[model samples]
Target: MPVKITLAQAMGTCFGVQDAIDMALDPIYRGKLTVVGQLVHNPQVTERLLANGVRIVERDQIDSITTEAVMITAHGASDSTKADLQKRGFTVYDATCPLVIRLHKLARFLEREGWFPVIVGKADHVEVKGVVGNLKASAVVYHERDLEQLRGHERLGVVSQTTNRLDKVNTILDAMRKLPWVREVRFIDTVCQPVKERQAAIATLLEADIDLGIVVGGRNSANTAKLREVIADRGIAAFHVERPEEVEPRWFVTRRHVGITAGTSTPQDVIEAVYQRVREIVAQPAAADHA
Candidate 1:
């Protein structure tokens, strides 16, 4: 029998990521540009940019930048951070996704409304850090257990990382809504549309007869990790891999149906490569013997 490989309809690079790369590699800023952080979460994308002459600098190393132009990655930054970079004389090119800008605005609005902004995401994630920094969040939580650190507030607002899986964020939001002392729980939806679609696509695939799933993206990609986490939590076998070479024959030996999902930062070509690789692996004569 032939192996069936299913690719998520919404998988791979988002508009924001392509725009960032375009601006970074544009002739206007070529060789003279430096991104304050990784242009996107995918290492392949960043490596391509770096090989093409884009320079990367950590946020703390802004003052050390010798370039005349700096690009703010798709992940975004606080208004204050942008101002500080401009103050130092670098021509700042903001490649922040418009959606992320809107998300930030929402967080700020929640804060101004006297709602304690509770971020549902990894505290160390670049997107989460920017959101928290912009909103001046006192604390952020990814799970119900982390809520113990949050004090009882009359009104609480929750926002999630743009690339986070909605199922995970919804789980956290559900827990927040059930909190006893929280009179009003404002669950703001900051998860990006593409991310949500990809996650939903994954869920649809997981519901099928697939023996396991493959999530393609950088290991450092927060959204990819969350998708993998959610899929595994559903009792499905899933692997988050960055490249085609990472695929193992063992993962598909007994599996006839394979589900493929990619993070927003993952490039389309990478997804294709993984898809083809899986098909090739399962075509081996002995592949289904273990099934």
Candidate 2:
């Protein structure tokens, strides 16, 4: 019997990620540019860029960079950081996603208007760090327990990491409204549309008769991990893999209907590669024996 494969309606890299990758690979700067961070969360994309002679360095290692120019990742950077780079005499190339830029602007605008800025995202995430950097006062909260930091403040201004789960963002928002000390609350929705659509698509894909899900993206990718979490939340078996070689044949031996989804930073070609691998796996006789 031929196993059936279904793909989520909305999956794979968003325009912002794609644009950043294009800029990094552009022939004009391929050899001269050094990206300040992983251009995107996907290792495959990173490897491809490296193969094309692009240089990537960690934020802390920027001091070691000898390149005359540097590109910011899609996650973005604080204005101060950009200014400092320019002050150091390096030509700066910004690849900040427009949505992330909007979040930074909204947070600053809120602070200017007398609201205490509160960002909803993982405190350590590069994107969140960019938004929180240089702010006079800000609190990063990903759970209810973190809300305690927001107390003693009368007014709060909130924005979220573009890749944060909408449900989590809403839960935090609702809880903030109930805090007795918070006299005034202002919120600007910062979750990007691509994330929202992928989330909604996964929910729709779960309604299908698939016995398992394959989530493709880099292991460190926050959005990719969230896709796997969503599948697990629904009690569906899932395999989250970063490469086609990681898709084991054993996963499909007993699964006739498999659903495939990918994180927003995952490339289209990567998704297709995984799909083709799945087809090849299911087509082999005694597929489980290859596992």
Candidate 3:
């Protein structure tokens, strides 16, 4: 009588996350290793790295440490960060997603061609920071109101943070066209496909007859938060939990069918554990009711 649990086919870690982990574990002669930020924004993944003896250091602490190698997260880092690390005598390990790196390169190329670069993403995000860092003159616009800050720009080039919502990027592009001075606006659709696919897949899952939704990922993970938002938008009960222990019994009280989804950064094992926990939670009441 255990509650039925269905996991999204596209759930769990993407290629970028997988690549970052492999790079971190590769045996290289990095005198001392330091990671710029939460490598994949998953505590369990971070803990695994810690167990493997990788040091996760803060941005400010990077300069003070004498590590021979410093890894930029999958989210990527600004050019300034890489320069600073090198200046501090650290060998840089670029673990940035290839898609993000491609966007950075595109921004630099457009800047050289006399196009004012504009990034459609969270200004504070590491990936956006890296993209902006490559630009000599650029603007970061997260909303329609922020577009008003643009000045005297006829020719503009746009790129987005790889993790940004695709619809928001399109809306921002539409808004940018309304600017009077904008003569030509070229947009590079750089939002990562894996991230978009996961999001779209979750949206499709939500349309089905599901009782409750469980989203798994780190609290600080932006993409993970977006997945939770999508589920909550359906007005169904949804919980964002990082681990199996966070699942509550009450969530299953009236739920005969539960849906499970994980962020791009989440590992497969974590998702499985969450599913097993959900099954156990749903089974308890049915067992008691029968008794």
Candidate 4:
């Protein structure tokens, strides 16, 4: 049987991520640069920066960085973090996605309006942490169980991580509104447009009769993980791989029709490589074994 591959209409790296990568690889900052975190959540991007003499330091390890110049990742940093770095005599370069910066402003604006800010996102995510760092009080919730912390607040202002799934965010928001103690629920749509487009594209792709789905991106990418979750939720066999080598030949044995997608941070070359690998694997007659 011949294998047919379908690519999603919208996928791969977004503009904000590309802008950050360009800044990281800029010749002027090449030798003196230290990125405060994984610049865009892709290992390939990280490797490229390292090869070009850029240094990467974790958030807590900023004090250990010896570089005179530092860059905040596309995920962004709190105003205080940037101020402290400047106070420490380091030249700060901001590569925060414009959308994420909007989220920060909206969240802060909500806080200032006498609304208890509630972020619908992972508590430990770098972007979430950055937003929370700017606010004195806020609740981060991803599930119905996390809504307990919002019980006592009179008015709740909600915003989501830019890359969060819209469906999941809506679910959490609906749950928040159901809580008896909550009075006013004000919400802003903060999820990035790229993420929503990708999600919508994946939904459209899945409408086809695909035997399985392949999602390419960093293992830690929240948006990439959500794409896989969407595929799985539709009962399709979903394989999430960061690189071409992770694509298993055996998985395609009986699956003749494959749907492909990539995360916002995934590089185009990486996505193409994965797609080509799948083609190569399915070309082998023995690769079609049911085992």
Question: What is candidate 4's lDDT per residue for 141-209, written digit by digit as tens?
Answer: 998999888878979999999998888888888888889998899999999999999999998887888
lDDT scores of the candidates, listed in order: 0.83, 0.91, 0.84, 0.92
Ranking by TM-score: 4, 2, 1, 3
Q: Estimate each model's TM-score.
A: 0.93, 0.95, 0.91, 0.97
Which of 2 and 3 is the better model by TM-score? 2
Residue 150, model 2: lDDT of 94
Worst 10 residues of 2 by lDDT: 282-291
Give a tens-digit lDDT track for model 2, residues 77-186.
Answer: 98888998899889999999998898999999999999999999999999999989958899999999999999899899999999988888899999999999988889
Best by TM-score: 4
What's the alpha carbon RMSD for model 1? 2.0
Alpha-carbon runs more than 4 Å astray in model 3: 27-31, 286-291
Model 3: lDDT of residue 11: 78
Model 1 Cα lDDT, one tens digit per residue, 1-291: 677888777888889888888888787777899999888889888888888788998898887788898989998988888889899998888999999898888888989988998888788877778887786655789878998777567588778778777777788877777778778888888888887788778778877767788999999887788778877887889999999999988887656788888888899889989998887788884854553
**What's the CA error at residue 269 for candidate 1, in Å?**
1.2
Against the true structure, candidate 3 reaches a TM-score of 0.91
lDDT of 3: 0.84
